[model samples]
Target: MASYSIGDVADKCGINPVTLRAWQRRYGLLKPLRSEGGHRQFDEADIQRIEEIQRWIKSGISVSKVKAILDTNQGAVDKGWITQQEELITILRCVRPDDLRFKIVEYSQQFDAATLIDHVYIPVRQRLGFEQNTVRNICGLLDGALIEYVANQLILSRKRKGKPALLISWDDPDRTRLWLEAWRLSTQGWHIDLLAEPVELPRPEFFPGHHIFVWAGKLITSRQKEQLEYWHEQGYSIFHHNPDLTS
Candidate 1:
């Protein structure tokens, strides 16, 4: 009957403590015991349940639907991405900036960055791409709110100690995606110094012993590939992130 604190469970499950609280308060996915001080206390069974929840989420199911799936012990019946996309589209169509930003923050608390990016953000953007000019204006609003949200997340992440890394994009037209990727890295225990604009590759000696993450929204040219290889040879830990290739 050993019990663990919320931080302990978050570390063990590779989940944020904020996300764990969201699961309990918003989604009812967990019901941990409260100590005399009103602190959350999780038992071993709770840990196992968290792993199960992670499995469902990794399969592209939204946290909002996880409770029902677990209760029924059934496979995902409806598409989570579609549901999330529809909700977001409705919010955007309302043309209310505050509501959109509020939902973005709420989503960040509920779901991990990767899940939010892949399931909700990317799919919504793609769906709106085929729409008319007025709808496309709404898409631009979403982008602005997302950029602001991720930037604020990055600032908060800096208060924690993590390995120092530089995040930059070379030839990515969308700065919002770059910021989103930077925030994603921050969640992975990286203290990110993000350069949102495309810049020439600096000398490895400038950031000695630092991880350099390069993001390209499109296919990299031959010269860009050579530059990356050269940086690798120069003892810089180079990681190329191409959303086009991965997504």
Candidate 2:
């Protein structure tokens, strides 16, 4: 039962101290004892638990969901039927091993990607703001899940049936922004070329349609706005979009 400081554990585990703090604060993942001076102190069991949690997370399980497995030291979880919105809120309120993702993929068998996004995801998203956490944390947690499950499905569906459009962001678009535009364009039967950051757009001739979209977010700089306007002036048919992530 030797003690290790937070910095020492982070160095040994190759995990950022800040990330560990986030996991603990958000998910109750760690139960470290505090020192007299209020520093976190970890023991050998804590180190081993951290490694185990890291392995499960690397395999795509969300932090909030890993607690029960760790507590029980069990491998099987009972599967039950829950509404997609409920499952999604579960992903936010209490993680359960990518179960939300599993449900979306499962539902896709019965519904097309567009239907799922419109009915399941969009409705769930609208209801997310009333939750107990700060909007930023709530958005951050759920957005990650959407990216893993919903966004990936939309991207793949986009590839299957359409002409590719040029999509770029002034910087990395918010998860909501990227997924929403991707869904909208994909529903319109267009493929996508997503650039997560500010970069030069592809030459117009190469894409033929020159149907470019700039997925701007709330934090656009004056220069980025000017760059988008310049693209508009060049007759490239560019559109700027910023998804309403707060809602």
Candidate 3:
């Protein structure tokens, strides 16, 4: 019988409040009760329904098609991420910077960062990796577009009111993945400050009271582990990202 605000639901479901509002206003996906103040109030059922929608999205079902599937209570139809990935690949191969940026922004609006990264961006990168000779050139183009998109998103996220957090990458070769990870966190309502460069373990005191998210694509060395443990003991919240977690 408990009621929750939109922000609470967004935090619990790992969705942006803007996306939740869009779901109601545009897609008619959610119908929450209105309080005396005319504010949206959600119950436990709404949270469960949001999770169901997330599962469908993670399974590669487009948002526009989700309502029909949910109403029918049918299992997910395998639309897959091929179409989206193909469109992005074409834009990248053509070296169309404007189209590429537009496509990336379009996808970000439709899908959350995690869904877009896992289903579209990462797959496109992998597909390009198999190219005969122009893999580097094409992937570089894609990375540039994505970096620009994420940078803008980061700036926008900073303008919003949210918990302050610092994201750092340690010895991770794939810089694009780090940015994508930060973008994913930012979409979840965190004001992210990302250290894009690979650096040694930083002193927690430098950013007191800020949650620290560490990304190490490789295995954690003992020294690094000790430093993280030290930070934990000093009352710092640390989120360590490794291959197992990211993969």
| True-structure RMSD, every candidate | 15.9, 13.1, 15.9
- lDDT at residue 176 of model 2 (Cα atoms): 63
Q: Report the error of model 2 at residue 174, Å.
A: 2.5
In candidate 3, what are the lDDT values of residues 16-124, reduced to their tens digit? 9999999999999999999999999999999978887886676446788779757644331145566888898888778898999888888878877777886688757
Model 2, TM vs. native = 0.46
How many backbone clashes does every candidate have?
Answer: 0, 1, 0
Residues 1-247 of candidate 1: C-alpha lDDT, one tens digit per residue: 8999999999998999999999999999999999999999999989978987886675446788779767654232154556767888998998889989888888888888977886678657756754788887789989999988888888889899888889877766677778878877888888888776776554556677778888765356678789888877767787787542443
Model 2: CA > 4 A from native: 1-83, 134-139, 158-161, 170-173, 198-210, 216-233, 240-247
TM-score of each: 0.62, 0.46, 0.62
Q: Name the better of 1 and 2 by lDDT.
A: 1
lDDT of each: 0.79, 0.64, 0.79
Ranking by TM-score: 1, 3, 2
Weakest 10 consecutive residues, lDDT, candidate 1? 72-81
